[model samples]
Target: LLVLGVPPAFALGTNKFAASCASFTSSLTFIKYRVYDGDLLKYLVFGTLLGAILGVKTVLLLDSSQLRIIIIILMMFVAIYTLFVKNIGNENKFEGVNKKTIAIGFIVSIVLGFYDGFFGPGTGSFYIFLFLTLLNYDFKISAGNGKILNFVSNITSLIMFALHGKILYSIAIPMALAMILGARLGTKLAIKNGARLIRPILISVTLLYAVKMIFDITNH
Candidate 1:
């Protein structure tokens, strides 16, 4: 949308709207598959919602250029690290809910939720990475849980945008329809293929976003 000349605020609102639709659909699919960590969702969603509210409130007040650069660097590091760690996300090592795991979930979700509400790029990917790293989930389950949390954050941000009258309903509605279908198909594929499919895609997405950020910064 930005490349197409839409204003940043409008693009952010529209993106949140469409993403809310997609992530909601994906979350339902993941639930149907029983792939998500139900025990931890409460912690994740609560922190995410709280952080999203704070982030939305502060979005316009912050200078995010430095943050974007840090995010790009982090994304690049994640991509490279994942590329070298062949078995990292291929096996699930989660040992059920524990105090330490719960704390990590809440903290990471809050931070990424803030990032999602503030700038909104690569939040899902970051969630997936944290799930894999901290929760010991395989790629497929990580993606499932990540999408669920991302849905919560997206809806929270969408509500804020809607309240502020930033959303373009005409564009967002049609885009949401397409997003729902695309999310359904993509999620089905991920479920079917598991880590073999998801790992490379995660790495690719992280690298692509990093490069896109670099491009945006250089262009600006």
Candidate 2:
């Protein structure tokens, strides 16, 4: 949608939010109880809600250029870690996450949500990585669940933006359709290839978005 010249609010309002929900629902229906965990899903949903509310406030005051630099640095760190950080989640051994970690996850989700609402870049990939590295969720599950929670945050932000009259409905509808199609394809690819493929894509997208932000900042 951004590549297509649709505005940010419209992009989220129409495309990403709807696509996320559709993909999540479809995945659940297709996979059934094999992978869906209700407790983990609740945490994700809560994170999304918290993030959306924070997003509303953050968009008004955050500096885009500063954010760009920060995200670039963060992505660089993640990329480097991915290269050398063997046993990133080995400490936990796939055990259920602790309460402290869950709390931290909630906080991180809110912070990221605010960033997403304000900047609208690499939000999905960020969530996936956070879950993978911090919470020890496998990359595939993280990506799948990330979509579910991200949809929640996107929808909340969209509603807030729409209520404030920021969304351009004309662009939103078509862009949304495009997003839905894109997300479907993306999700299928993620499912087929599993975590190894998803990790590289996440890094690539984050780096690209980081570079775009840097370019925008420099141009401004």
CA error at residue 213 for candidate 2, angstroms: 1.6
lDDT of 2: 0.65
80-101, model 1: which lDDT tens digit per residue? 8888988898889997888999
| Best by the lDDT measure | 1
Model 2: weakest 10-residue lDDT segment is 29-38
What is the Å distance of residue 106 in model 2 from its true position? 1.7
Cα lDDT tens digits for candidate 2, 63-170: 443566778888777766755775452222345656876686777777777776776667777777787777787766677666666667777777777676766667
The C-alpha TM-scores of every prediction are 0.95, 0.80
Among the numbered candidates, top TM-score falls to: 1
- The residue ranges of model 2 lying beyond 4 angstroms of the native Cα positions read 1-36, 61-65, 86-92
Task: Give the runs in model 1 whose Cα sits over 4 Å from its true position.
Answer: none
Report backbone clashes per prediction. Answer: 0, 0
